[model samples]
Target: MRKSSFMRISKSISLIIFLFVCNNLQAQNQSYSTNSKSDFWRNVQFGGGLGLGFGSGYTDISITPSAIYNFDQYFSLGLGAQYTYIKQKNNYASNLYGGSIIGLFNPINEIQLSVELEELRVNINLDGSNSNSQDFWNTGLFLGAGYRSGNVTIGARYNVLQDDSKNVYSDAFMPFVRVYF
Candidate 1:
């Protein structure tokens, strides 16, 4: 009877150990599967802005390219590079190049709030010849809000650093569009 009781106890302990090991393996497999779904490239977005404007004797063209990483469904961070050219009737032309750091927050399904910090190099050619030019740096902070639909976003921003005496833009309001893929 003593030997029978010992065998029964040993069998029960072995069953419990086997069950514990199986459960742990299953949990590890689930964790790995979840991580694989959100790989690095899967969370990346690519898009930018293209702008063209023409008036009586003025022309403006701009191109910007950007990349963003989605930290989750509600937040994203991005970086962008910009190039712009402007020509006026009076033989005044300007070339602007810059880079920006962007942040976005989505508090609801269709609303987005954005902020951008930018550093730009401005080259102004007083003569149409382009040989006589001046170079300077301009920095701006822009605050914006927009509506997003599908892969497109439309927004308007106001520049916090706009100064009529020193800044290139006489107006502080700018409109923008962004597409994502």
Candidate 2:
């Protein structure tokens, strides 16, 4: 009789635990469903900031600001401007204009694939005594994917560039971070 009583108590406890777990899981599922019902890209957000670019034998610290317009749940456009300080003892600098297209896909939430193009005005001071500067134009294209959480975005990209006039300054891979408010 005692054994039978203990078994009854155990079964009751098991049933209670199962019901509690099921209730919690159902609540979680409902919350997720409600959030997923809204179109993710209806809101347009704009932001910009500073960054550092490090590459082979050169490191560039920069300020970059961007404006983004989200059209729907899948596609967006971004436009940005950047100024970079090239630390080559003589303070070589460049100003850049950037544009990009962002596409959002599933399997990874809040992640986007981006394609970008940049036009840069690069200046170099050939001599320390010369007040005059040599100016050149460079253009770049990039393909990458990004993950965003709240106001922060992080990504990796492969970049290609060419100086149209001189046929110089090739391409490289770069990683980046962006924030939006």
Candidate 3:
């Protein structure tokens, strides 16, 4: 082969090899991004709250379970369930069971905001000694604000759907602590 011809052939082969390598690298990077997206469960978190109180002739107990799916670092949506029981010496006994849906937002790393809607069934037995009972359904919408750190938050919420004369909670405002894993 002539010197110029040999040199041209070598240069062409080198360019082809370089282009092939670059194409394969780009394909690999695309594949990696796809695999990363499939890791949906990694963004899910589970948590809730529990409470118990007892005193002379009075008892209260509560349990809540919740799960949230983080869409990104800034937002999440969750579902929750709650059950509560209360007994007063001779006056009454009550059971509250409920479900809720909540939306959470983090405008900054340390501040969080939330909105929650809840539906509850309240059942009460009058005069602990008799079978006289009352049952009703209650609904509440709450707006909340909190301070957040890692997987924990401390917050307060105000119920937009509260009645002054008759409500499960003593006040329209309530405080909370939340933790998730």
Candidate 4:
């Protein structure tokens, strides 16, 4: 082929190859978007907390496990289950089992505000007396605020539905330290 015609053919081939690559990339982009709609598991995060307290003839143990689905970077909703056992030697023992639904909001990168509604079933029995037992259901609404750093958040929560005498929690204010992956 002549020099000018050969150069022209090479340039045309380069343009065609560029066009094909661009079209292929665009198709891949569309495919990713479609698959992202069904990728619910990717947005889910799992986390939980464990607690223990011990004293002379007294013991308290709690287990909580939770899962949250991140709607975006700023908002998430999750469900948590809690099991707590308290023993006071020669006095009484209590078993508390509950579940809570929580909604979390991060208005800023360093702050988190959460609202949780919990329903618990409490059972109390005396050490030596089997006939005298108490079983009831209690509900608590907790509003919490925290300071966030990386995956850890330290904060306090106030229970709006706390009772002075018949309460599962000893106090209305509880502090928590949480870490999430």
Please identify model 1 stretches exceeding 4 Å from their true place: 1-38, 55-57, 128-132
Error of 4 at 130 (Å): 3.5
**Model 4 deviation from the true structure expressed as Cα RMSD, one decimal place:** 8.4
Error of 2 at 37 (Å): 24
Question: Residue 42 lDDT in model 2?
Answer: 40
Residue lDDT tens for model 1, 99-146? 999998888869888899989999898865766677889898999999
Candidate 3 TM-score versus the reference: 0.77
lDDT of the candidates, in the order given: 0.88, 0.66, 0.93, 0.92
For model 4, what is the alpha-carbon lDDT of residue 92?
99
> lDDT by residue for model 4 over 92-172, one digit each (tens)?
999999999999999998999999999999999988889988899999999999999987889999999999777688899
* Candidate 2 residue runs with Cα over 4 Å from true position: 1-42, 52-61, 90-108, 129-133, 162-171
- Residue 102 error for model 3, in Å? 0.6
Query: Which whole-number lDDT from 0 to 100 does residue 181 have in model 4?
Result: 74
TM-score of 4: 0.77
How many residue pairs clash in model 2? 0
Query: What TM-score against the true fold does each predicted structure earn?
Result: 0.73, 0.56, 0.77, 0.77
lDDT, candidate 3, 69-177, per-residue tens: 9999999999999999999988889999999999999999999999999999998888844556878898999999999999999999999999765558899999999
Please rank every candidate by TM-score, starting with the best: 4, 3, 1, 2
Ranking by lDDT: 3, 4, 1, 2
Q: Which stretches of candidate 3 lie over 4 Å from their true place?
A: 1-38, 128-132
